[model samples]
Target: MPIRRGSDIGSPARTRSRKKSRRLWTAGAIALSLPLGLTAAAQGNASSPFGDEPELLQYEEQFLTLYETIKDPANGYFSDEGIPYHSVETLIVEAPDHGHQTTSEAYSYLIWLEAQYGQVTGDWQPFNDSWALMEEWMIPSADEQPSNSFYDPSSPATYAPESTDPADYPAQMDPDVPVGEDPLADELSSTYGTDEIYGMHWLQDVDDTYGYGSACGGTAGDPTFINTFQRGPQESTWETVTHPSCDDFSFGGENGYLDLFTGDASYAQQWRYTNAPDADARAVQAAYWANQWASEQGNAAAVAGTVEKAAQMGDYLRYSMYDKYFKEIGDCVGPSECAAGSGKSSNHQLMSWYYAWGGALDTSAGWAWRIGASYAHFGYQNPMAAYVLSTDEALIPQSPSAGEDWGNSLDRMIEFYTWLQSAEGGIAGGATNSWEGDYGTPPAGTPTFYGMYYDEKPVYHDPPSNRWFGMQAWSMQRLAEYYYVSGDERVGPVLDKWADWVVGEVTIGEGGDFQIPAELEWSGAPDTWDPANPGDNAGLHVEVTAHSQDVGVTGSLANALSFYAAASGDTAAQETASGLLDALLANQDAQGIAVPETRGDYSRFGDEVYIPEGWSGTMPNGDVIEPGSTFSSIRSFYQEDENWPQVEAYLNGGDAPTFEYHRFWAQADIAIALATYTQLFGAEE
Candidate 1:
């Protein structure tokens, strides 16, 4: 994701992730090492649309494994779509991990996967199962239900009290809610080990959820059933995946895709078609699409296209998004070190997360290419995943002031992308606001504090300019989704790695609320902060009471995990997705946010909040999922407003989005989630 102002400038010297075995390129290098392109017809073959290479098999197996973990079963509710699912009740209390299920993430990815391989084999049991749980429980409903997700413990369901000091470290489970009487206090588990163990446990929950063999009971009232979250996968997510120039194409057109009038072949062609069917290709293309749309599609065009696309796709919430793509890196993965611009942190992520999608704005992100890579795969309310991914890149430059340098890869700006999460599923670095402590010493500005609160109580807090669990929301999820749709190779590991981190942080205790071990604290110390100051932001703080950083992260990982399991055939990812699905379902509001239109099984979640306003923003199509407004202003996310209906409506796919503020405020990083998530979890979500 782009920096939150005051970070290093330009790109940071990245850590190399390759070897030195390939033959050296002679002065006359013919770009010969690349593989041959697959024909359009052959591209979608059953043997992996990307083709017969060894890597395809590897990814396929991985996908299968993840799928197995999350696929629906026969023991619980089933969706007419033939997907299996478990009830939030059992999913939460019985499951020992993965309480933070990402509702919106699951739906978007399932739609894309079905679009791609439906005919050959289109049973999204994995996605469906996960979706069922999320829909049933995770979202905050008017019924005042509580999700197993620790992020927002029980705003509506139980109505427990929340915290007022997000800055406090080493939090107890119930900062506000009375412990013994709390609704989920008994079912929620505890996070009592190294952050890694906590994450692994959550991962285990995801595994178990998918392993359940019961199919979702029905799909009758599923709110987003008819919404075209993804386009026909038969066609390349871009214009022409197999086209050689695709490396340069920027998905654009009257369709939810992209077509920069300048006509760069599908910049994503290089991405997805590096054979469009490949994961790497998809990741790269998604980034290209996102960048192109934002840069070339003027605001008026963007607004019209977004609203029209939402209508066409059958979802009022599926607006426009920054694709999280770029033209420079077309279809190839970055070398151990990324290309100058391809890997260079762009500012669009910060500004775009909150402003796109008419009045629907929210964001996601893992790190770096957050907005530039994941919008399509993760930013779906409709079939325009590719377009939203593209839009992510366009909104960077306008983020709130005092932002960090896009490329700087440490502390405030660069930390979260490649870094790990804390015991409570919290991320670290300088997000939220800048100025306090080292955060306040930006090259040109001061930092502000942005911590999470739950049930009206504080969970984690960072010093001014210091963010511990902060991330680029919309962008992070979008990048992961892009990896799946565009078929980018790096998509696999990227998604996996990040998921691992988030899993360690978000988990349920034996009591069922959520937990964060004290050992995971890496805040305000020499190891955490720079030595010059001997101080950093607060430790990695994740809580279940109010808004937790994991709300953005856990959801993104789960969504990607579901998809990757589908693509690579990985059971682990599948299981993880299932656990997340269940948790999210238990926490959701039946008719709020993403209300199931029909009502069988499955419901989308999240509230609408513009970028630059809150810590996280909505998807690229401009649907606000998270809360926003003035990062440092405690009142921003602290107040209890009457936007509940808006949140539900948007989550279930808004019918009337007001895209008047597609101007992401530098900090909202939702636009860049996919790329970031993909960079970590492999192809899962």
Candidate 2:
């Protein structure tokens, strides 16, 4: 039977979901019901021959095996044939934190799948289906938010929709909630004073309050961006409650990254109501939409949409780097910047060095070539582009203080970049920058690093989130990349800080026992806040939100281990990676639905659990791991059914010709470590 996801059922609707799932148990059912059959290449290419390589043949077999279980093109999201696609009517736990459009997720995965699987199956079906979300969200006019700069854009920074109303959501009524329940009321109960998974339900609240903008459902109040003084930290986190501007003018808030966070706490706090920066979400959704393109629908539109989203991503990235970073003047910061240029990393200043420091290989400056041709819209990857994505960059001393260069990328390179930022972060939240060092806690009302940045105090965080510091490995990693590529002198110490911090924060024993960070109270015991000491970094724990033992802490440490050990001349770093790797190895599942018997690198097999009634049931707090649990997020939503084939293919060397599958920072680190060992210690033999 289809393994029950959350609550022995699926989505938010509990009735008969499992029963319907049971019908399409066998892989054969999915292949027969959906579009897994031999799909002819477009036009005259239909007669093209199938795979000839052994790797291709192996990957193809795996893909065919997943014929069933994967979502069918029945007009809904990832599902098998005739499987009722969950709509607003049938929601999985109150919609998720930031995934107002999970289809974007489908699209993102689809892009990865196409790069990894399409060649094996000669299929564009999956990629096409993933992009289907464009039909509803990615439109010329619909893309822009009301009063957003893209729309009216009166002055330099002023945006008409500076403050959003909480009562409005999803434009109008949504079936996701109870039939007649007041969306505002429902959302209030969800995000209000809580950082639990349900807190994300605030997404709908923000959309209703603010109205969906161009960066439609991309990200909301992402902590990484929110913390930056560039955006002016003084703005009221709660759009409905306050409107305080540092500068005399508006901040074109609806555009760029501001629209990611929700004004209301009841909905998915990460559920971005606005959608101005449309590239990321759209590409992600296009990946999911690709699976459903098995029909006569040629996949052209989907591919084109995917390409378009990539283009937009490229443009936005350049805008962010050249224009936004170099030129923009905010209240807290001025137009003038560090003379060191790319060599700055103490704070959010890391963004400017994205060309050489940030892991922009996949999105920022080098996103185009890193992704593919359609992705070349970032003008094109020059010298620094390839450098950030690889060790070949020669390690420049862009930032003398931090050192290290070339972060991570999405080209199957590393998992740290992806997992460290979002693994424990829950599927519905915003991506974070880096983890907090020394396990410090934010003061009360100062926004706990749990997830959101503006709301720094865990006290203000009613329930408090666990996504932030938990997944901040990304920052350190990109810095290391910067050092490796740019040859910057600052990287040595910066790498040490990250490496040491990872070991200090996350440690594993002989067994799979993980030692998460527990900040020494000193003054602040359980809570990190202290009234006595003014401005002391009381306490912060990214582990606060990550409850699962799977990816949250483990994945981050693994990523840290990989990067720290990959270069550092220190034998201790290598030892740290080894110990962590051992624990990861112990958790491997041989017959797991996701990938094959994984040996060596753990990236091949991410966290994929087959809990019988675990997720399929209710939450301890009564809230379901709706939308999805952190477990699902780890594997990039990879499960045994259809997507696993590609995951397996990439993992087992069946598909990964180049170590590109090491695209994820964490995953790439593992690859880099292995490559290093092979060079020094020689092959395993």
Candidate 3:
């Protein structure tokens, strides 16, 4: 029998495993240096579409390890409840040494992956597991909240709640305040050290419940608003509050976690709110498709449930769409300072995260300035969700905001693409919102929040203004889908423009020097932000330079271009897409190493700081490399000395970082793109 890792249970490709080898690019230059051995296709005469079935299966198994790693076998669910999960179960302690909680974005990724896994193999376990997670832990408790009745986590099969009563959850309330005060305002004040805004008694829960509270309280059925009686006369002597239902992600609160002071003297406070459009969008997509999968399995309830769940999220996402920023120094500022205009205007602009407290936004009133919007991703699935919800009117309870027409979704996409398309014919990676934090003074014409105790004067870094091919490629894929679905005449030209953009950006050189510059800089960057003050944009303007192509960006482009070509009947686009695919295949490891290149996995592990003026190091080819040194005044490499040797060797060999280190996200991006490519165009070249 051939060597097996786990669950290998004899595969036909196993017989030819010994013969498999890959041709690696030589260390010196981009040229192919030496012949290693036979490729996977040559070794097994593989018949699977994407590449080798066994190899892909192995990669899948390896990728699933992270999920397993984060799982709590004892608890029978994922670990890490606080600061991440909104489970009312008190025994569910945070997983030891585990990664960050997969609340907002990871939920969608897992949903998408589960569907893909089920499609490939005749197994619904992954899909079932993913759905169970969404049903059990992700969706907020809706027992008390009528507005959040769309996705109820009341099923006994998947979720076993320790306490069903709303009064059972552990929370504190103030006795002096009235009973009907706003829970959201009180919660925000208590959490962020602000004045108690509401006169009604506030139920203060832990961080885990913030997202749930934001969802439940922001919406109508405030399940998290536990009704408590006063136990004592003093203000702090109110009875403990407990949630009637588990509410998480039911209402869209973009902030993921609290921004605690890290003791960094230069920064007063830094609050980062993660709003991954790609993750959230894909989750919606998964829900739309998962319903179809469920229907195929003869689960009508699941079919309806999935669509309703997706619609709920889609509704929440609408609140997060581009809205006017409050300009009254602390009010909703529209037309002039909408969050959409503050960032680069991608047609469907979706930000992964919005950082506040660092002077990124005008937060003089408080750090919780609610300006909703995110940077855009190409494969936004909100449109699909809208279509599904609109078509299946009876299955899901329609909200005026949630049940918006498909036209609304299309317009969002149009807006994103409009903002994303650059003058350079490439789509930027969205705007970088960085301001220097030194200047305590606010800029002229801006409202000042100087006296607020909890609100700290924030300084931002030099704003990121550049285009990323990876993001552009992903956007192209979404555009292609939109065109295919709507056949909108306007989208056709935009699609063609993006196709041409890809052709210009993606460069295939001599001896398989296939590469795409990772990023292109903005036209102008102010050189010096007020470094003297340290809290404001002093006067720093740095332009971004390009970096080498990686598998993720290339894979996305390959898939998008393939879609565009097929949709438009553009032969040139088709040819370019084919070449890109061929290049990707050429780069694949025959030995079945799933080490897809990512930009930043190994570089983060450095204990020793390697800060240089210009070039970090030289390649074996006698060529100096400066990866994004233009904007960066000083180069810094935080590398662990012991691990540097191995990492350096991998880099020299033009190999990607190790899989175990960057599993969830980096793994998913490439896997999803490639799977999508295969789905779009079968192996028949």
Indicate which candidate wins on TM-score: 3
By lDDT, the candidates rank as 3, 2, 1
lDDT of 1 by residue, 1-685 (tens): 1111110110100011121122211111112222222222223334332236532223333333333322334322224443322222221211111121212223333323322221112232322343344333322122111112222212211111112222221112221221111121112223111110000000111212221111112122332110100111111111111111111111112211212111222212111100011111122223233233223323233223322222222110111111122212211122212112222221222211111100000112111111111111111111123333223333222222111222111122122222223333333332321111111122322222211000000112212111222232333444444444545453455456555554455554221133222212333211232324433334434342323323324444555554454444455555455344333323322211111122111121221112212233222223332233221121122113243344346446755322111111110111122222222233211
| Residue-wise C-alpha lDDT for candidate 2, range 299-349, written one tens digit per residue | 444355444443323222322122111221111111122111121211221
lDDT of 3: 0.34
Per-residue lDDT of model 3, residues 1-685, tens digit only:
0000001000000000111221121111112221233223323534323455443333333333323332324422233331222221221111100122233444555677666554444355566566665555444332221221111111101100111121222112111211111112232333334331111111223332222344323443222222111111110101111121222312211111110101111222111122334445566666655565455546546446555655554543442343112111122222223222222121122222221111112134222222222222233334444444445553232444334434455554454444444444454333212111111233333311111111111111111222344445555665665454445566676677667766766666433357765654543212121223322222212232675646556656665775565556666665555455445444444221133334343332222222122324321121222333211111112132233455566546645444323223333444554454344433221
Question: Pairing residues by index, what is the TM-score of model 3?
Answer: 0.49
Please, what is the TM-score per model? 0.27, 0.37, 0.49
Best prediction by lDDT:
3
**Selected candidate, larger TM-score, 2 vs 3:** 3
lDDT of each: 0.24, 0.25, 0.34
Off by over 4 Å in 2: 1-77, 80-312, 318-467, 518-553, 588-685
Q: Which has the better lDDT: candidate 1, or candidate 2?
A: 2
